[model samples]
Target: MTGGGWRRTLPLMPASIPSASRENKKKIPYAWELVGWLWLAYFMNQADRQLYSVVQKQVQEALGLTDIQTGLVNTVLIAAMAVMMPIAGFLGDRLSRRRIILWSLLAWSVATMLTGFTGGLVSLIVIRSLATAVGEAFFVPAATALIGQYHVKTRGQALAFYQTAQYFGAVSCGAAGGWIAGQYGWKHSFWLFGGVGVVLVALMWRRLKDAPKTAAAIACSEPIGDVLRALFRTPTALVLTLALGCSTFVNMGCLAWAPTYLQLEPFNLTPARAGFFSMFYYQLFSFAGVLLGGRVSDKIVGRRPAFRVELSGVSLLLCVPTLYLMGATSTLWVVYAMLGAFGFFRGLYDSNIYASLFDVTAPRYHSSATGLMVGFSFAVGSLAPLALGAIKQSYALHTGISLLGVVYIIGSLALFIAARGFFPSDFLRNQQTVPTSPKL
Candidate 1:
């Protein structure tokens, strides 16, 4: 071009750098504004989920529930998560996540607030369980997918930090819920927790815009059938779905029955004391484990991505044993110690879950990929908690907890197989003795 033509356009661009350079330097703005909202939203998500376990006594007394009836309260919530997650997944991949998340936070928070006024199991079933679950379900798919999109190279570390809010909110919610329920009653605690969420929802409404520009941007206006077809066509997506489902089964089963076990065991603690002790130990450890795992995996993946994921497998392997041993042990010190270890490993597994998914799926597929993974994981795993509750009402804690190991092992195995199939060198490079070649 002529010098005059170039000179005229030069004013539009930065004189020091080319247009290409500017585009590269233009930050995506994902982490600072977007991921922050997502992280906090997830934190509140878990805080509400866990607050119930800590305030079980006040809720039970207020409603006059029996053991099975109390068990139904938890089952209702899990069932909501299980049933709603798939539909949430489809919506996340098809609709604007910003809207889905905002509505979700609002719906759940409102339900939680209403839960404070419940007079019976029926109210608990509708408000706390079903409505709350439906709200909670949409956020994770939207939020987690956003995290993966924003923090490409640092997906594990970023998600771990975001997820830490969950542990923080969970652990903090327990301590706070205990105090609130102690002071005002369980009803007040739910009101307080739900109120904070409602305020955050308004804030999210302001900050969160529709990022309809991600994977779903392709057919931004297409029919639902095309999106569904795209999801099933991915091989890595299918494997991840099964792996996560198996992992969640163990988590739900233990979460539901463990408290009842602790309350009745040689430990023989009251519901309130048991609440403080169990949530304190496990969530605290889970907090530490997740933080540590994220950092460790980040370090490991710098040299090798596959190695980082396989390192996460060690957490599950350790978790199964530690959880079982914790339940078996009678001493408070021993129980706490083992519980801490279990939490650490559990964090390790969770920290790497979507990071592993990111490693296999390309960046464009982040939402739909996680949608598939989250859908099957929660849906399939939802059965475990209900089953465990029934078992606790029928059989020994030993039997129920012991059975959970089977599911945990299966999760580890599915991941192990996937790792072996594609990245066998990772485990060998890692501490595990996994072979260097795929058998097939």
Candidate 2:
């Protein structure tokens, strides 16, 4: 359908649509440039997040912390992010997203540097958890929404490229952080990564620009309550949020503990080796999967939007066995193989996450919906680390990890339902309500 046809179908369509769409079409080069900068920012974001996990043992020994205390550090940070994301999302719609992105980068970079000075659990919670979380929380809703505005046809590919930073950052930090902590102490690792982030902020300040928004766009901004209500009312969005939560739960638990797990008994690997191996194989395969999944989804989604959600569902289903086997196996090689498989499936789902979400949501509410989806997911995910720590005290770490497969089962089922029962109507409504742009 034509753009005018779409606008006519929805009485509430914002008047800013045509001008905004035209501006996006003309700025395609700048859009890719924007992704290039955001890529580096996101790399640092994931790297900072994984730094403590890679050096967990060293930090624990230095601070005299137990397993649960270590777990609480990650839990607190994620919980803080959960609490702040909705507010950030709301602001992203009304405020200048460029400023929000830059300020968030500055705040988090400063927090990361200060994390090196933490003396105990309280200080860690204060700097790493609360301070960093607040900054990081503002980033994604703005960044992703901004990207969505610039690249309509290539949304999956653009986002997939962006998502690769998460894997690369985690892997780099896991390997480098362990070596740094092992040789120079964990404090030095934090200082190094944090400094890089600070420098990056200074460099990106003048380059990034927000999508053009007219007076009508500003006038039509929805309240937080209305945004929340709209997101929850969309069945596909609700299902996608639940799926994200399930995957995040597994990811948080595993990323936080896998390095430590490999250091124990049968593996008996050095901290550096453990960190490298735990992240390397999985993320390597995930890198490949995301690239392939993104290309495939973008090609097919024009004719079959439901296939995007279906792909995510199928990927999660494939992940169940691999996830279980990765935790259950005692053999190092088998564990590595399972990790690779699990990561590949995870990449498939990750590649289309926001692309799929955007399919069912109107353009105006993209940031708010992203915030609601991510906030709820993180809130659900925040319990993983704490729950695993308790399980470690009561049973075994591997046992807890194996049980995460059940979460994936629930998640896959939810996505399948959304794909089969809800996505068709939701996608159709979205296309009808928003100005039709290039196909994703």
Top-scoring candidate (TM-score) = 2
Candidate 1 lDDT over residue span 66-116, tens digit each: 766776777778767867776676667557778888989988888889989
Report the alpha-carbon TM-score of model 1 versus the true structure. Answer: 0.83
Runs off by more than 4 Å, candidate 2? 1-28, 214-220, 436-440
What is the lDDT, from 0 to 100, of the residue 301 in candidate 1? Answer: 66
Shift in Å, residue 40, candidate 2: 0.7
Clashing residue pairs in candidate 1 are none
Question: Model 2, 1-440: lDDT tens per residue?
Answer: 21232221322323433444565777556768899999989999999998888998889999999989989999999999999998888888878889999999888888989999999999999999999999999999999888887777778999998999999999999889999988999999999999999999999988988777743234136666787787777999999999999989999988899998999878999999998999999899999999999999988776666888999999999988987887888999999999899899999999999999988887778888888788888898899988998899889989998999999999999999998889877877787666543322
lDDT of each: 0.69, 0.86
* Stretches of model 1 off by over 4 angstroms after superposition: 1-30, 210-230, 268-272, 362-364, 422-440
> Candidate 1: lDDT of 3?
24
> Which has the greatest lDDT?
2
